[model samples]
Target: MEILPGEGVALVKVGEHRDVVESRIGPPVHPGRSSRAVYETSPMLVLTYTGDETVELVELADGDGDGGEEVFFDGVQLTSRFMDDVVADLEAKGYEYEETDIGYRFEPGFAVFSMGSRWARDLDPDAAEDDPRRVVEGVSVAPYEYFAEPAEEEIEAYISSRQSGGNR
Candidate 1:
């Protein structure tokens, strides 16, 4: 599954990208740009969380793998690798995730932080607090946190680093 990165992360985060998205971008990294993050699955829907206190519910597709095809919501095809990244970030925060029949879910916001209401009820209400992988439309839900800010040194190294080998 080819998942599209939040189409305007940079634009939405830094430049003029509001027309493409709904929520306002978050902090220095833009504090709230959880635009609908739909994934290709059996029952797809608009998933988003732009640093809001409550999650919003929108009736989208019925999960048909075509979620990625829709440009209206900036569909990002959910894949195992994507889930791996989410798990990695969560694990960094000392969180453990259990694989589900769906995709992947975690705590402390990221992916599991703001799941669609239709997607939220699938799991045990008690499961939300303890579960790392909440069920969303029969699929595990996760965040494409790959767009998140990197560590300071990492950022510095990247900013200072330059292309060396050109014709070599």
Candidate 2:
């Protein structure tokens, strides 16, 4: 599968209706209540819908180590690669990102999370930087608003505070 960032996967795009998605990929493996659907594709596909039933978020997650499928973003393979390597490649491509609690959130609506160890809720701190535990586990794409900055009032407040050294 290929991620289109602020758009959607190659098979579906954000803002597409649920029926359109179902027609292209068939029915979801498990229909979620109201606003979500899960499909049993190569790398499992999950779609979140808006109140009007249009796709709002698209997620592709790595399946078992059996290598069920592969996923890519802008031609760069995402699944199974080390987290740092992926970040480096993205940076090289001029994609700016912010480190999230789980992984990295890139501009224009792309985010990836680490898998971590099965026994731990978070990544194992003692694991080597190159450890497999740090490979990307899942990737998500959404509309620009999903990664947009706060409201203008909030931004102005923050700017004013910073200028006054209130936050320092």
Candidate 3:
């Protein structure tokens, strides 16, 4: 599974049950907890899961030459095929995921299968917290062009807020 590129640490919504989580990034770096597991997919990317669903994705920018990870980007990417494989894997592993008119429901309003740019974008403040209608036709299953990097100001602000313990 190709982990798409961009940046951000998103909290993925998960089902109530705690059991297996299906991921191609491999076993988690931390798996002792029944509610969550964390995986460092690469030196730059970190993923977290609860039950069979992903709950968070954190992107670490390359070291500042002093060998420190820098938090950056409010954007991240996951391909359509990747979403399908995750659902298929969940089903194969005996997990159930609910699909609705909006998209595959993830924590009520969010979705594991929806459309957007490779880069993450802010939700409209006026939109409902869990609106699946954000996407055209309520679902997305196509590839998108890779994202160009976000502005330095955006990156810096995101990093600063993250370091100050703000949640995105």
Candidate 4:
């Protein structure tokens, strides 16, 4: 997809939606409500798919802030590198993909982005769940709360600590 360099998405408000929000990029996509379209401006092309509601993504091509191309992921090449340094502190992780061409749905996770900045990893739950980019037919739905539920081991650990008369 070759979204125009200056293409961007309008974060819609909840409870206000167009019955037929259309998009035409490389070809005829999203001719009706039966499918949702995710329009990308930078990298170009809108992805059309069959699903519930409109959860599309504007795929931005890697570019500099000046629209000169960007490098999406820079460092950390191999699994070994992450496993040795980063993965050690992690537990209970899996992937759940939203079946849409627009954007992706990350259940039980968080994102952080400033007013004029891009999103980043590990967002504040209260804040991330309130991202303006997240909406369906003008209705803002609740974002999946990451780390809301404790794993079994974490629960057991908590119990053990309390029972052991240790500081909580």
| Highest lDDT model number | 2
Q: What TM-score does each of the candidates earn?
A: 0.22, 0.74, 0.23, 0.23
lDDT of 3 by residue, 1-168 (tens): 222222233321222122333333455566565344445533333334434553433222222223433322112222222345445554565544466543353321223434443211232346555544332111211112112235899899989988889654
| Pairwise lDDT winner, candidates 1 and 2 | 2
For candidate 4, the lDDT comes to 0.30
**In model 2, where do residues sit more than 4 Å from their true spots?**
31-33, 115-133, 148-168
In the range 87-116, model 4's lDDT, one tens digit per residue, is: 222222343423233233334231111122
**Per-residue error at 23 for model 4, in Å?**
10
Candidate 1 Cα outliers beyond 4 Å, as residue runs: 1-81, 109-168
Query: Candidate 3: what lDDT?
Result: 0.35
The model with the greater TM-score, 1 or 2, is: 2
Superposed Cα deviation of residue 150, candidate 3 (Å): 25
Better of 1 and 4 by TM-score: 4
Model 2 error, position 109 (Å): 2.1
Candidate 4 regions with alpha-carbon error over 4 angstroms: 1-10, 13-16, 20-28, 43-142, 146-168
Worst 10-residue lDDT window for candidate 3 reads 137-146
> If both were scored by lDDT, which would come out higher, candidate 2 or candidate 4?
2
**Which lDDT value does model 2 have at 43?**
86
**Per-prediction CA RMSD (Å):** 14.7, 7.7, 17.6, 18.2
